[model samples]
Target chain A: MLRFANPTLFLKLVRWLLPLAGGAGAVLLAWGLYLVFAVSPEDYQQGATVRIMYIHVPAAWLALSCYSLMALSSIGSLVWKHPLADVSAKALAPIGAAFTFLCLVTGALWGKPMWGTWWVWDARLTSVLVLFLVYCGIMALWTAFDDPARAARPVAILTLFGFINVPIVKFSVDWWNTLHQPASVFRMGGPSIDPSMLTPLFVMASGATALMLALHLAGMRTEIMRRRVRTLSQQLARQDGGS
Target chain B: MMDTPHAGYILASYLLAGVIVAGLVLLAVLDDRAQRKALARLEAQGLRRRSSGQTGEQ
Candidate 1:
């Protein structure tokens, strides 16, 4: 991680990893889908509807985890002045927003059949909705400012401050009175969900994480290039401008 | 299982995955090309400035 503080090394590392991550993400997702549909047994009660969890739950996990990653990177940016950390967090917002949106959409689909409602204000659901909005606010703040450095301060503060919500989202179903179901995968004793259902869920979650990594890397690369071009253009403008 | 009849959920999940993943891959490819092109332009511009500077000295 420290080695990447040097831009030259970081660029080289990203160059090699991007293609590998993209290829691996594609292959893993294909295999994961096969396992989700063909191999995993259908739920006795929910039937094929349970299959939504394969996508929904994984996205929900990533949506939460990505924000944490962003916050942690922001802290590194502030404390250690780690080069590219802020840029990394800034790049992650849109990807996390998409995952959060996916989670909500799939959750609603699952809810319509399972809970008899498309949009319940369940504690878990509402908290996650807020988390998604927070992601949007962070992205907007970063782009709103004319100066990138000025933008980083407030955006980093907000990203770090919002770290409080990650645990709340994880425990909202259990902590408050809500219609949403409690933790099944991360409970202390064991996962309450049966193995038939759990296997596909794990496979899909793994695939989703890989996909997010690929997306995050690709987005960060674009951001890096954009910054470089902006710098060059600014220099060119200064040289050509009249005295 | 048979009585529930929930193929719609499965279809939706597959469709969403296909759309999102394909869209991301397309963006990555296009962004990579755009970045490379911009970099090339900057490099050419830099070289042009240096050549002009050298000719002015001569």
Candidate 2:
């Protein structure tokens, strides 16, 4: 892993991997959407509206996963001073935030019909809401300081602190009596949902994850370039003043 | 118009997701290009200054 720490080496690897990741993501997304629209069975209880889960659940899971990833990477940045780690965390924030927002909105959409309300204070929902706020706080911290390192320090610490909430969000349904449904797909036995629905759900979940990775890597590349430009511009100004 | 029970909810949700994802991707690409250009320009300026500095010293 550290062998590719050199920026130029990393860039070359990213260049080769980008097209592959992006293309696979596109194909998976297309197939996933096709299955979602045409092949997957509607819920016996919820009817056509269950289709929203194709996008909603995946976004929710990805949002939480992305935050956990950012927190882990932030630890590396703060402790080991791994250059790419901080870049990865910084770049992933907006995309993760967007996913979290979608999860909340879509979950609300699903809830209004299924539960007869637009919003609820269920443990799962409330925890996810806190997760979103945590993301927002990290983003705000990133810009609150003029010194880049200082700005990053608080975010890193916050990320590490906030990760404790992820597990609570994940298991809130099981841990506490809640409106949210218990785990169906990830259980000791197997998915309780019919295979007809599970297939497309898996496809869409994979596609969404690939899409997340593609967006994240692309964003990370841009951040690397951005920092490079910032450093270079400062050097140029310094040289000009020196002479 | 597709008011089949909860169709409006599903449609709205999908639309929002699409808009957000597409907007983010476009912004990422734009930022990448902008940063690369800025770095190129700065490097060029630095090169010019270093060359001028050498001449002044001689």
Candidate 3:
């Protein structure tokens, strides 16, 4: 993992992996969607609205997972001072934010009928909102600095602090009396949901994961090129100044 | 399948997810293409990367 910190090597790996990720993501999503709309039975309670779970759960899970990844990258940046760590964090922010944002929106849409409200202040919902805000804060911090090198440590610290919310988001329904449902699919005892439903959920998750991988790889590649451009422009300026 | 009372909400959720995912993919692809183009342009203009060490201009 550390060896891939070499930007050139990272780029080479991304070059091969991006297409595979994208292709697999598309295929999984198609199969997942087919199962979601055509094969899976509706929730006895929620009716067709349960279909939203196909997207909402995976997006929510990925949102938390992405932040955890960013937090790990932050630790890498601060401790190892690995050159690619900050780039990984930066590349991940908007993608994670998008997933977080989607999760919120989809949840709200799903909630309107089931909960009879579009929004709520429940522990799970609120903490997830905070998680979204943290993503935004990290992204804002990234652009706040003219130099990414200077931004690394500050973002790293902020990410570490924001990470306090991840577990809260996970266990919120349990920790507090909330409208949100407790874990059914990933509980300690084992999944409470029917296997038919569980199958589509995992498949959708794979699709989301692959889609994220493709985007992250492309973003990382772009960031590397952006850095190279900055370096070359600086060197050109230096040459001109010397002449 | 589409007859459920909550079909609208389900559709909205799926549509929103599709849009967000598509938007992210577009941003990543565009950024990658733009940066690669910029790098190529810079190299064309005698701005070689230090590591590459292949001088583009005399």
Candidate 4:
């Protein structure tokens, strides 16, 4: 982990990792989609609409997981002041926001057909919505500062503070009466979902995780270059002024 | 599956997810290209980074 703190080494590593992750993601997603349509059976209660769970559940999972990654990166930024950690936290914000948006829209699409509505102000739904807003806020905070370094601490602080919503979003269904279902795939008693559906769901999730990693790696690489550009331009300006 | 009731909703969900994911991929790729271009232009102007000795191309 500490070795990766060096930006040059990180860039070299991502050069290979990005393609590997992207290729794996493409393959897994294709395989997962095939299983979703061909192998998984329709739910007795929800019928064809249950198919939405493959995409929706994975989006929700990734959204939460992305936030968790950001929060961990934020800790690295604040506690250790690691350079790559700051880049990671910055890079992940938009990706996390995108996934959260996917989760909400897909959840609404699933809800309308099955639950007879587009949305409900339930604990789970509302908390996820808050999570989306927090992502947006963190992105906004990033742009608010003129210097990326100046932005790092504030963004890290906001991220750590916003992490309160992650567990709330996860456990919201259990803690409150909500339209959202509680812990089907992950529960103390083991998965309530049948094996037929669970297989494709896990495949889709693994695919999504791979894709997210690819995007993060690319984002980090870009951010490192961006900082380099800033530094080079400043140096050029200084040389001109001194001349 | 297309004949299934509420298929439009399911299709819409998948379509939207595809669009968002593609958009993210596009953004990452474009940003990377742009930064690389900027760095190259600066380096071409003979303004090397102070730490250029320790690092390769940005």
Which candidate's TM-score is highest?
Answer: 4
lDDT of each: 0.79, 0.82, 0.89, 0.91
DockQ of each: 0.30, 0.36, 0.59, 0.79
> Highest DockQ among the candidates is held by which one?
4
- Estimate how well candidate 3 is docked, as a DockQ score: 0.59
TM-scores of chain A across the candidates, in order, are 0.96, 0.96, 0.98, 0.98
lDDT of 3 at B2: 85
In order of TM-score, best first, we have: 4, 3, 2, 1
Model 1 chain A: which ten-residue window has the lowest total lDDT? A4-13
Tell me the TM-score of chain B in each candidate: 0.66, 0.67, 0.81, 0.83
Give fnat of each prediction, in order: 0.43, 0.64, 0.89, 0.81
Model 3 TM-score on chain A? 0.98
TM-score of each: 0.91, 0.93, 0.96, 0.98
User: On lDDT, who's better, 2 or 4?
Assistant: 4
Ranking by lDDT: 4, 3, 2, 1
On residues A7-87, what C-alpha lDDT tens digit does candidate 1 reach at each position?
A: 556666777787787677767778887887678887777777888888899989999989999998889778876668887
lDDT string, candidate 2, A1-243, tens digits: 787675556776788677788788789889988888878877778898989988888998899889988988898889998878888898788888999999999999999999999888999999989989988988888888765656677788889999999999989999999988888888888889888888888888888888888888888778777766666667777778999
Q: How far is A224's C-alpha from truth in model 3 (Å)?
A: 0.8
- Tell how far residue A21 is off in model 2, in angstroms: 1.3
